[model samples]
Target: MTARTRIAAVAVALSLGVGVSACSTTTADDGPLVVVTTNILGDVVERVVGDQARVVTLMPPGADPHSFEISPKEAALILDADVVVSNGLGLEEGLERHVDAARADGVPVVAAGELVEPLEYTAGDAAGTLDPHFWTDPQRMVDVVDGLEREFAVAIDGIDADELAQTSAAYRSELLELDAEMTSAFAAVPAERRALVTNHHVFGYLADRFDFRVIGAVIPSGTTLAAPSASDLDDLTTAIEEAGVATIFADSSQPDRLVQVLADEADIDVDVVALFTESLSAPGEGAETYLEMMRSNQRLISTGLSP
Candidate 1:
């Protein structure tokens, strides 16, 4: 072959090789990649998986899981992960399509939210809708940890089962401790003052866990994406006045305008407090991790409901 032809062929081969390498680098690496949809589940799965795999959380800190959508890059990560973990039952409203696409593409997905003994709205316009915000109750999150460990170990090629089990157990212990502390903290609130009003119906599990009454939600639905109707607001305002609720809690990740409307409509003395309900906050904000989120919420709820 001519020398010029040989040089051209070598350059072509080098270009093709670089393309292949870039594809491999973008797709994945040595460790298993577990893509989690929400920061709350991301933190819990991070605890269970430990260093066994690389956990990539799609939702950012302080972002709403119910409405947060992943970018194309993050969607690619989901498709490439060894296993995709999502909080199912409609919590991830914006990301569901991408998650479904990943599942169709053959990625094993563990919807940890399904592992919980699910709660449904008892009495609201959205009654009977499954409550997807199960992390409000730490015991339910313990169930999530159990499911994640099982699925991650099965899907990840070389994940250490022993390490996963130990980490899950340790995390469950911590959740139990949190449950106990929350129960005790809530017990301080008088029964009459245990009424809960919130920006949305995001805390059914918490109310069920701690024996508090879910008087009404400002949005009248399980999701913040749903706005309350005029009648809905009117009825809730009446209920708030009748229940003599002292506090209305709003999500820290959401704008408080709708909640402010409710407080104004009620025209009563109600403290509007913010809680890290649907998402964890940035580090040092007291709701960085799942455990930290629960503790901070517990204190807030206790103080809000105190007579």
Candidate 2:
């Protein structure tokens, strides 16, 4: 090759290399650093942030929000995050300390559930105590998305405000559609048959939204961290019998054997319907996203409750 041709080719290669480097640097710097406590909230953050941020979820897929514990490395990740998102309101019992530590380290810890209008459980002796499972209702999750957007804007400066606003608006519309679909889907069940029996008391918001009654739970508390006594199980079984609840909705993340034992002892022919409650399913599972999880649950509940 001529010397001129070699020089020209070298210049072209250098130009291409510089362009690729510039693009890579821009992408790395433009994406905001985000961290979520659970996979469920991670999915929601993904929907909101899209490609504008780098999101790290502390909990693995299908990990129980109430009982899943994180390691020191994960805890360090939380502490160093730009914004740490969590369901809050005690839903993440195992990671609450790490979240608090994150806050102590000056990381912004956003509690998505605190943005929602919380509902209280009125079953048995525990009346008027707030239920932490707000994501059960899609409308409440809309508020959570709003809170997350605000947090993202504050944490991710230099981002296009208009773009973020537009993204949030679009996500809000999707959430509204989900809310309407769930309302219509749940309405098909007969009113009396709308009673929900579950392994834990995690459906207060869902029951409130769809006019279903949460008859009883095997755990008898909003959180699975709380153990149920034999007497508590007896009382719940009695309530289930009295209410004639045909289905006990068990969390897919939790063991269903306890509920099976209860069902066998009751001998009431009640079916145990497994639903995604606290955490979402693994990718490719039907209930991987929050919207899909809610719809799947709506279908299961409505189908199980229908006459």
Candidate 3:
């Protein structure tokens, strides 16, 4: 080959080598290690992080956030994480200690619910406390997305600020759209029929957002671990009758025998609707993601509330 041709061939090879190296570098620096406490929050984190983080969810699909128990190995994984995201306001009752340990280890932990304004509930006799089930409100979840983006930026060092900002904007827009959809869906129901009775105090955020009153819960506490006394059930039955609540929503993960008993004792025509409240559904099932879960619950609410 001529000397000029040889020089050109070497230049081409060098250019291709540089391109391959750049691609490899980009791939290697793509994201950081992220640990999410539950599958529900994990879905939101995945959307915000996109392809920019290695997100690991501790809670398995279909696991109940209220009662989920993690192994020692899982705790270790959380301790080693760059960032740990939790639903916060007390959703993961069983995993709180693990999260506390992770924080003590100096791992950055973000509570998505803390970003949004929380709702406080006071049973008839107990002291008031903050409710942790915030994902029920789509707009509040937008605040969670914002918190997730900020946490992601801190967790994933060297992230392009422009890319992060753009992602946050896009996700916020989607959340606003979801909020509008939910508003329209619930608006079709008469205002008097907007009350909800659930297996537990899981819909406080939802009720607050959509102007629906949470008339009663079969279980009076936010977590299912708290059992309602017979008097609690009696009070709830009274409230259900007074509010004319037509449906009692139960968690699909919890046994419905108690809810059924409450329904029978209430002596009212209250239908029980099982919903994916604290956990995402298994793959191929509806409510597998945060958005899907909200949509599914909205449908159930609309159907139940319709005359």
Candidate 4:
């Protein structure tokens, strides 16, 4: 081979190598690329992974997981991730397609809902359906951490298993502290006043966890995509009156129009309060992380339900 020709070939090979390395940036990091579906789960995974992996969260802050769609770039992220963590069981209606596509692409998916013991709505339009909003209960969240830690140890290359287990234990301790705080704080609310009328059936786990009664949701369904009929609102209004609920909680991410309308329609005066029920709030707001979100919601719920 001529010296000039050999030099040209070497240059071309070097250029191609740089391009390949740049293209695999996500995978070229220190550890595996983990794509999380929701901000809440993202926070949890971030805490568990620490600096071990590159955790890319798909859902933005204050966006509803049920209706938020991903961009093409975010979808590509899922396709290229080493593993995907999602709150499956139909919570993420809009992101479901991307998750399915990622799964079909042979990416490992660790679903939180499937890992924990799922609860079902007893009444309302979504009766007998599995409830996907389980993070309201810290116990279930600990289960999520356990599941995620296991997945990370197995799927994420270069992940330190002992470190992951230690981090999981530490985060689980924090979750337990959150549970204790919630239980102590909620003790102020008498059992009779523990009735909850929220934006939707998003607190079945919370109610079941702390022995609060889920009076009913304004939308009468699990997801925010569903709207309530006049009859549904009327029934909820009656339930509120009978339950003597002082405050009706609405999601901070959603419009409070329905809760206000129900409050106005009820024969008995009721206060409509907003809570960070569905999505995490932006930084500086009370609920930026999963733990903060739970604490903030606990305070709001305690105040709303207290006599």
Candidate 5:
């Protein structure tokens, strides 16, 4: 072979080698990725993981978890994730397939719901079904954090165990403080007025934890996607009147139209108060973090119900 031909071939090989090297460098620098389905769990995972992994949160702020869909790019990220975090027990109705695909590919999934003691809905369409909105109870959130700490240690390869432990412990401390704060704040509401009426059955855990009663919901279901029948509204109105519930809480992400309509239809006066029940709000809004969300809701519930 001629020297010129050999030189040309060598140049082509060098170019291919450089391209492959660039790809490898990008992958290494990108590090491990953790894909979280819901924004609520996203905040928790980010706090626990700190700077150890890149967290790609699919659900945006103030978005409904039950019906939020992901783009193709976001779905692709799930399949590539080293570990995926989700609020399981049928909470994320939209991203189940992507989560399933990631699990099928042998990626680790940390379902926060599965970690805590689950409660079933007592009266809604989801009655007898496991509740996924466990974050309403800070004690349950502490349980989730505990599970996440253990899972992150094993699932995230090459993570600094000491750093992970320190971060998890710090966050867990915050959760316990939150629990204490909630307990104290909720004590002010009069026992007779300790009934909760919401747009949906999203506060069962809160009701259980704080010694409040779960009156019927406008939608009469655990999911926001469920619409209320006229009879459902009638039943909830009767519940509100009988329980002497002066205020009904509605999810900020959802329209308060139904809540208002219900209030109008009620024989007794009912005030509709908005709360960050399911999703977090944008930065500078009331709820930007998990702790902030819970704290904001705690204050809202206490003030909205207390005499």
Candidate 6:
């Protein structure tokens, strides 16, 4: 199948809320296939690869990467893919077996987390473990793009080197511009109020990059699958009170009930704001791409924290 036909099929499947495998049926005449685990990585891979390959992103838009499961057909796509891209560092809990199977079958797998300098959770159950949400920092994402370009040139057969170089360079420039924008936007906020409390521990990289303090998280764990105890909530409330945080940011892909409960039950006054932290939103929902997601979060964080 041609690139146009494959893109049309994927668009139709997404419109109908179907699995990625529905549009990723391969043929002898088709280009190379790239099976990506998360939509965030998928967006970057698509931007890097352009139309030279068929990219099948397993995780749907606005879905939690920690617990989203895939169909058998999607698993088959991984095994049959020329290259498989994942966030790695244990982010995709539901697709580990499939990714391992593809690796065992001799397919090249490029992990974004491994490409960037990973950060560890500072105060949660995953404190000593590697954090997989490196996309939170656009500089780290540029590193991943550099790695992807190198990996794709080797892994994807018949890929045009000149086209890949051009696309990757263009996307890298955009990421650098995004990093500068975020830095500028965040610089306006007072340093004393640059504390962040989220629904989970998803912003360690962002905090490290932008000189913000991660006060605490509602869940107190790195993954959304973990729950926060009453003690966790109490401690976070105390920390919030001490820091005098005016806004608590929650993941747009996950429910903000825990955040809301903390805001309502706590004696301190705090506003619960949503940010596109982990997953991208659906079309026209403000965070359709990685760049859009970062810019939206930058604006929200600046406005939400400014006194």
Task: State TM-scores per candidate.
Answer: 0.89, 0.87, 0.87, 0.89, 0.90, 0.90
Give per-model CA RMSD.
Answer: 15.7, 17.7, 19.3, 16.2, 17.0, 10.0
Backbone steric clashes in candidate 4, count = 0
TM-score of candidate 2 to 2 decimals: 0.87
- On residues 135-225, what C-alpha lDDT tens digit does candidate 2 reach at each position? 8888888988898888788887676777778888898999999999989898788898988888778888888888988778777677665
Q: Which candidate is the best by lDDT?
A: 6
TM-score of 6: 0.90
Off by over 4 Å in 3: 1-31, 124-127
Better of 3 and 6 by lDDT: 6
| Model 2 score (lDDT) | 0.76
Q: Which stretches of candidate 1 lie over 4 Å from their true place?
A: 1-30
Each model's number of backbone clashes? 0, 0, 0, 0, 0, 0
Candidate 6: which stretches are off by over 4 Å? 1-29
Best-performing candidate as measured by TM-score: 6
- Specify the poorest-scoring 10-residue window by lDDT in model 5: 17-26
lDDT per residue, candidate 1, 1-307, as tens digits? 5432333333222112000001112122358888888878888887888877777777777776666665677778888888888888888888889889989999998988678889888866679888888888888887888888778778889877898899889998999999999888888889889999988888898888888888888677787666565566677878999999888998887777667656766778888899999878877899988888889888988888786
Error of 3 at 223 (Å): 0.6
Note the Cα lDDT for every prediction shown: 0.78, 0.76, 0.76, 0.80, 0.81, 0.83
Q: In candidate 4, residue 125 scores what lDDT? A: 74
lDDT of 6 by residue, 56-139 (tens): 888877877887888877788889999999998999887888999999999999988889888888797788888888899999
* Reference-based lDDT, residue 243, model 2: 88
